[model samples]
Target chain A: MRDKNLNSKLKNNFGAKANDSRIYIFLVIVFVIIAAIYPAFFTSGSIKALVSTSLIYIIVGVGFTYVMIGGNFDLSIGSIINAGAVVTMGEFNRFYKIFGGVEGGDSALIKAWILAFACAIGVGLLIGFVNGFLVAKVKVHSFIVTIGMLTTVAGFVYTYSHGNSISANTYSLVDVIDKSFVKIPYLEVFTPRFVIAIILVVVFEFILLKTKWGYDLFMVGSNKESSFFAGINTVKKVWITFIISGFTAALGGSLFAVSMNAAVPNFGERGIAPLMFVLAATIIGGTAMLGGSGSVVKTAVATIVIQSIFSFLISMGMGFDAQVLAAGVVLGAVVFFESFSVYRQGLKEGERPALVLEAEQLRLKK
Target chain B: MSSDNSASVVTLKSNTGKVSFNTIANRFGVFLMIAVLLVVGAFASPRFFSGANWLNILSAVSILGMVAVGVSFVIYCGKYGDMSVPMVMALSGVISVEFMRYGIVPSFLGAVAVGAVIGLINGIVIGKLKVNAIIWTLAMNFILEGLIRWSYHGTQIYPDMATAVTYKTGFLLPLMAKLDPNIMNIDLTMRAENFNALAQTYFAGGIPLMLVVMVIIMIIGYFIQSKSSYGNKLKVVGSNYDVGNMSGIRATTIVMLAFMISSICASFAGVFITSVNKVGAFYVGAGYDFQAVTAIILGGMSLSGGRGNIIGVAGGVIMLGLITNILNLFGVGTFTQKMISGAIFIVVVAVNANSLRKLGKDDA
Candidate 1:
């Protein structure tokens, strides 16, 4: 009996380790499936496309993860992306006019790209600051507040643009985005956008893992009251995180607009997919959705894996609509499956399932 | 025990402040905005006060009212809702139309069943697994959308030949036809003929089935929320799980029951919507979850759980209906209307919180 008990404990410990490793395992399995289906998936062209798309999503996802990790959500990101697109395109257009560039093509394209990106990021920061302030300081839950913003800003997109598309005047930016560049190939160039995504992940990972603000974020996420007790100035951390999230999402929006070559009014309306997919990626990467305890690196890798699976599916003749349906089914099933362990624990304890909620709060205490 | 006394004392203290004062205050924030809007609308448009305008308001409120009723349960239970009400409504409409080939009853049942299943999944995930209700429900929403899109191949569901040609088009058609010719140029009327009439007309052209149903559901919801032992249990569960567990309430079960209630309400709304609209689409429940949530918040139901009743939610629904009506009467643009509604929602919720705080309970 003693030996059996000891063996069971060892097995349990190993099981816990495996569970933690499940996300990585899942990513590998997905990649393997993609590779098996499309042998050419590993080629430079495919990798470049996958990496570029993954970079855009990752940038936005990482910013969003910051808010989720802090125990809130920003439904406004999609609309914000739309807003960013509008802002960038509008600003780029005006700048081109002032600088007297040729219509639809430009000698000043590179400088215009830089200026547009900077302006886009600024707008993103401003929106994020407002969102963060309303939620943290004004004491409103993120959902209601963001929903309000979604409408107001979505309206602004229509009002400012009068429901029209805005295009950048920089042909060079478009040229750089659509095709290869130099011998490196923009597709395989490890472009600035890709580099920016990586840098963001690394910087955020370091800050979250090592900085005082990072610790405060964890504390606030874990338990708001306790964080208050710890003198973390919990509200400031919450507000700042939300603001940073907004800023990062805006940057992503600008890049996305550049890649797409036009800023469509519906840009933000399509945020549902990005929002849910990012959440799934974050959670699958072993970040607790309950808040805190996640890494941007994990989210970044998971984004690649998810995009690859999606691409593989598309390549295999699954229509775009079916893929959308499949994503939803996958998300629902994954959340249900992953959370089953906690439910089972509740069952074993002969306690009501509600007892499991305590685990979320309990983790914070630890 | 001491804590129990303290809580009870607090509840009792707040109970004396005008039976519906809390709800009124919560709604008052939005009401104030609506009042301003009414003044502006009346000044802007001469037709704003016509009896026809009031009828238009009632007609418009019917469809969203169905959704709001269903979501009220989820909010009341403190479950984060964002489930596939839109898809459920759309699918229910589709399935119903398909069944209309066979007969009316079959179509109605098929549509409602799909809605119930959607709600069932929502309940299992949110209630049983204790996942983040909003995230889980949001996922479910997309999945339902995917299903609807795939099944329809991204097309809208239109009325069936059998229903359109055979059964007098459910009962809302002719009434709307008559009303449409005299109305303003605004095209917001339910394009599907049958729905407009059923919602607009009642028995013998007097009371609308939609309004009757709304009232019935509201009353039932109120009874469940206030008078039933089960309702009391849910209240305790939502208010504070620890205290509820100590009090011998199974918080998980209570929460699940709440979700089930919400799903049923959503299903009922779905069937009625199909009957009325004669069509369903991806955008059916697009902004509804948030809208209903806003209404609940404005109704003074605390987000932290267990503080208000269904009557409060009813007040919110009515007020929201009123605001939409007033806006339409004045010919405000859709984009502007959305902004006004959103801003009003935020301010109303804020004011609701303040009132709740003043009363000594956390407003959440």
Candidate 2:
């Protein structure tokens, strides 16, 4: 009994990876509960709809999680996604003209798809790099830098699209996005989007957990000064996270554009809603806001779980307002609980979280 | 803080015995930008630098000015912005307009009270509980906005003339009637006309009453941030709460007051906005929270708290207004103007950050 107690404490207190199991357990419980209460949730159609609806959020969120783990924010993801969508269409439009507009054939279609996707991701990379440069090198707070990016990007997209939705249905990417790679009877069908999202989760989660670069990024976020002393390139690590975040967001945005066959940017040009959702989702997924910890897989699973909870509420006849309200309530409660836990944990440890400790040293010096 | 600032000045003088113009230009970049904007406006268009246009710009920015200064207090205290500003505005305006059958004073009073309550909750949850300010307030924003939309059936509430009734009180009744009938004090028929005329009515030449309120808020915000002991306490708290606690400051109270002050200000802006649109909906002030934050940052308010100037923030607000006005004067389309304004925001902030870095004050 004594040994077991010591083991539990050791496992729970020191490792960022420990919470991974609890979240997975929670996912299992959520699944069982929902499955039992609303058996229709087991239906393939319901599952497919659920995954489809949450796929983009999950995809954007995976990249967002990397940034959060590195202790910064990329608030312009939604706008980047919007930009991705716009760029995809613009590229496709230009390339389609060159390749052959109406009778473009499969070759033109293939060419446009490859080029558009590459260009869209390229834009995301560029924007993300700029955001990184501003925050890391220019020494601006990440929040304001990303916000500046948001406004600039939104403005550019709004100008490009003239505040109207740009339809790219003719490009045929939408039809390709929903193509099912695998079908599960009475449960769900795995579309290319869902497959890509999972593949991203697995690959990024591995990199985040096992790579030296990933470890350095976490160190920088957990304590920049210490990491700097330890000879980690704190600047480079933080900057790299922004690029990853930008790439993922851009990928999600372009995919969204193709899936919808239109760049419906009027709603998301400001990027606030997507930013809010990703923030809420990451926190809910158990990524520490103060950094030093997160899981891409957990965030993806949590995104799906959150969607399920929404579906459950809708199944209970809750209106759209109820979903929004519930989301807010859940987010608030989670943040409050998370902070309270940290405060309590600090009391036991006899020192506060790094956020407070760092601020204390810095401010008192002045 | 003033002494500290002056001490720096003295040391700089002792070290060099003179000030570099480049340093001054970088340090007072916001002010220099405003001057640049003014000159550019003058050169770019004939109608850009007129007295009337300036008033138009000032009046146009007053609502945002009220908000930026309002949020500045919270930033001054070192909290992330009140993400609920937009919802607070929407809900408070709807509440005030719904109560407009009561006198305008009472209506505004009621709305402000509601706003204060929301602020208090934020204070408790964020200040006392130490929740992440950004996410918690964001949650509060979503919850309140969702609740308002749900209850109101996702529709904007237009002021109803038929339901308008002047809530009469003692000796004030006569004064209210005499001054109010022009604005449909009693009903919807005259509300728009009265609102238009009231908006047009300037308290000072080329300066409206809202601008006056904006100025007063800035003065008060500045005074509280710098001169008052409370302000010092707030800076201490913002700089480091644990340290502030050990030093015996009522950190909780200071934070609560900061939030309450912003929310109260939001209530006033809310009413102004609702009246301006003559309707209340959840979408009202949708982007104001972000816009206000940008203005604050542009004005030289640091995000880490305990470091900023309200006067610079005021200049930031004016620069934003100037950007829009100048762009319009140049006959730029709406889409292009947004791009230009955003670009300006990034460039100006980048320069500010670079200068601060050069000064050996790092944000990252």
Candidate 3:
């Protein structure tokens, strides 16, 4: 009897390990497919591009991973990106032109870059702070509150743009933004935007994994009741997660706009596509969607894989719509497969006959 | 000693009175917002009282109203409301248009059937497999959108030339002919069809069909949500699955039924939308799902599930129409209207939360 109990425990642990390995194997397959398509995809320039895009997603995903892992949802990430892009672009254009040597010269670009960086990061933090306040302090469900924010931000974007694109030429900062930095095997890829994205990811990742506050957040997310019993400030942790989600999304939006050289109302409008992809990857990385376990590294890797698949699909003569469809299918499949175990478990304990039958059938097949 | 114990128990009950009221009110808060908005709009806008504007508003709301009715059921069943409403709508519309060349009946039936199939898939995933409704439904939305895009490739189909002339121009011919005849009148710079009709056609009389259909759907929703055994079972299951299971309620079936209702409503909404637009595309139902969600929220429905009524959702649809109409009267731009709408939505939700909090405190 003792031996049987020990064996069952071992089997359960092994099943979980097997599940984790399945996701990793799937991610590796995606990477392999990309490499098989284009040798150049693995080159320095492509790597830089891939890393840059991944960096944006990774930053945003890190914040959202906190919320999702913590057991909340935010639909406002897309809108936050739009809001972030508008803020960063507005600042870059306004200051860059003022400091442009057309009025003064080379020194003007540097000054504008510094100012743009500050504003972008500041705007992100501000949005994050508001999201945190509303969600944690006011005790509103993040989903409903975020949907409202989505519409508000979308409206703001349209209003701020005056229904037109903000051109890069208007702000002479376009020149400084286009300048790329090469750092041997790995390009530091210095754009005022790229630099900010890297710094935010590194700093935020540290705060999430290495700090007491992050641990508190993890505790609160894992179980509010237990956290409260342990004297953790659960509400504060919830607030912090929302804030971080908003800030990171905003920062990502700004970087994307800076790279594209314009802030259109539609800029980051479809950011949900990338956001969902990041979510799938984060979940696939063994980060519990029910809230508690997540890794910055795993999420970063997933982001890269997603971006590579997108680029590869585009290269294979797929249009924007097809690319989106393919990505969605891939994401759905991954999540479905990843959560299969939990789903199977739910069925076994469930009183529903249909679910029980299905579970039995699945077991038989396996 | 028994009498003394009774007195303390009464005091304890009184102390907890505040919480019950708060909880109940929070559950019905969306309905309150809808009522308040409609009342405010009716009084504030003179044009709102006109028969034609009312008809127009109802016509505009029919699509979203139908979809919201479906989602409310899903919420009541305890699963996250399916987010594939837009895709389902588009699917039905696309299929309808594809088969329109055969006749209206074939097109309509085909679309409805397709919608049913989609709902079945949703049911299977959410009910049987127990996939997270949000992700599963969202994924389904992508697949539908992709299928539509891939099939249509952005090419939109217009009504048959004969149908176009007969159905569309027939209504306008009398007005157009009258305008041409009166062209010589100095005061008739604008045609009667254009100017006189715009001012005079304040009430559309030929819309009983849509109104009747809308009421019928609401009645059905009411029956399913409030009166039916299935409905009561779903509520129990949603409130607490363990309790429901103990009662022998089939949780998966209730969930599946909810998804089916949502899909059917989405399909019906798409049919109405295709009628309104006279064409369908990938973006046909793009924003409709979100609008329906907003209506559900506005109707005092809880996102967490287990509490809502069709009457509330109907009131919500009416409120949404009134808000937009009122804003239009003030010459608000689309962007401004969106901003105001979003602000109002958030405020309503906040108010609901505040009332609930107050109730909680009172109970404590």
Question: For model 2, how does the per-residue alpha-carbon lDDT over B80-171 read when each residue is reduced to its tens digit?
Answer: 68878998998888777655656567777878998999999998888887776776777788778767766655556766432433423111
**How would you encode candidate 2's per-residue C-alpha lDDT over A291-341 as one tens digit per residue?**
888888878877888888888899989877667767767777777778887
lDDT tens digits by residue: candidate 3, B196-261: 122122335556444566678889999989999988998898777678878888888788888988
**Of the candidates shown, which would achieve the greatest lDDT relative to the real structure?**
2
Model 3, residue B60: C-alpha shift (Å): 2.1
As a whole number from 0 to 100, the lDDT of residue B334 in candidate 3 is 91
DockQ of 3: 0.29
lDDT of each: 0.71, 0.78, 0.69
Q: Which wins on lDDT, candidate 1 or candidate 2?
A: 2
Put down candidate 1 lDDT per residue, A1-366, tens digits, no spaces. 545554564466777777777768887888787777689778787778888777767988887778878888887887777778888888887777766677535456556666777888887888788888878876777876776787777777777677889887555676565454444643464676677777898899899899988878877887888889977887888898888888877888787888878888786243236666776777777776668667788888888887888888877888766778888887777777767866776667864333454564568779
Candidate 2: list runs displaced more than 4 Å. Answer: A1-20, A169-171, A182-188, A268-272, A351-366, B1-17, B21-23, B160-207, B239-243, B362-364
Global Cα RMSD, each model: 8.3, 7.5, 9.0
Give the worst 10-residue stretch by lDDT in candidate 1 chain A: A351-360
CAPRI quality band, candidate 1: acceptable
Chain A TM-scores, one per candidate?
0.87, 0.87, 0.82
Better of 1 and 3 by lDDT: 1
Query: Which candidate has the highest DockQ of all?
Result: 2
